[model samples]
Target: MLMIKSWIYCCLLTLPPILGLSQNLKQEVEKRIKAEEMPAIALEILATHLSQASKIRYYKETDIGHQSFECKFILDRLWYSVEFDENGAIEDVEIKMDFEQIPQAALDKIRYSLSAYDRYRIRRTQRQYTLAFLSSDDLLTMVIKGADELELRYEIVLSVKKDGSWTTYEMLFDQSGLLIEKKEVVDRQTDNILYQ
Candidate 1:
């Protein structure tokens, strides 16, 4: 009887987080922060590449259960963002892109992938770079220099009209326009996947 009681107690103790997991899965929050608030390593990495960068902004972002820091700026008239994990390890870099930026074949594939929706209105498009098989420095270099490499992927935000209702979604497509992940936005009005 005591053993059964202890097992029940253990399950009850862990039940809260499991129950909260569903509520937490799609939650994301963004807050503007000062440069000094960024991790030292992230700041050092940014300083190396932000020589002529302008309009730089620092943001602390929380997604699901993970926290990250991002530095966004305009470099050569293009918006760029560098994200670092809570531990100060570089995560990825993103650059704003346009429909025309996607390769012709890839765009066709991307369109085909979205054909199921009645219509998908694009809200935002960006090229994401991560240190997949390369070092962070190398990945950052690829991002700044516009070098299309292995770690490149496209992150797109779209509003889809399906079943006569509009729903916002954030989609990630690989460099070849293959669908990676599609996450539905909880609330579009105040949601911030990437800064506007």
Candidate 2:
């Protein structure tokens, strides 16, 4: 009985340290996620939403502070993407269409449209750029024109997916906080876009 009691005591003494180690690991993981600004809860939400889909893929974390999830309904030949915030809110939704792929011709069209405004003269004041989602595919570029006359130019790329979804991959903002140029490159083979 004495030996058994001693063994039980030893076991009890080891249990707290083991539990502490587990808790420490959990805390470390939580810290890393927060430091990285990853939206784990958001991924969970997206996973639930796409649970019924036939195929689903996830991309790397976005620089814009959101996580992206791609879903494909093979039976319906449909594909879409959903972006979520750190807290798991549905930040954006994209619907894939057949013409989602942007051919070289469409690139020329975008260039033409943006080229029409050569001399952008905005006030020489400070402004802020805000991210706005026009639709699942369309990210509206917004900025406040400054007080003085400001002249600037830039190029931006908009990624168009097969389901007619478009997004701004990357953008450049001038001093007045106006977007001068933007470039959106779509990976047709992977249905992913690198917004640089």
Q: How many clashing residue pairs appear in each of the predictions shown?
A: 0, 25
Candidate 2's C-alpha runs over 4 A off are: 1-44, 64-75, 99-181, 184-196
lDDT against the true structure, each candidate:
0.86, 0.39
lDDT value for model 1: 0.86
- Tell me, by TM-score, which candidate is best: 1
Highest lDDT: which candidate? Answer: 1
Tens digit of per-residue lDDT, candidate 1, span 63-168: 8669999999999899998889986777998889897779898899999999999999999999888888877666777778877546678999999999999998
TM-score for each of the candidates: 0.81, 0.31
For candidate 1, the TM-score is 0.81
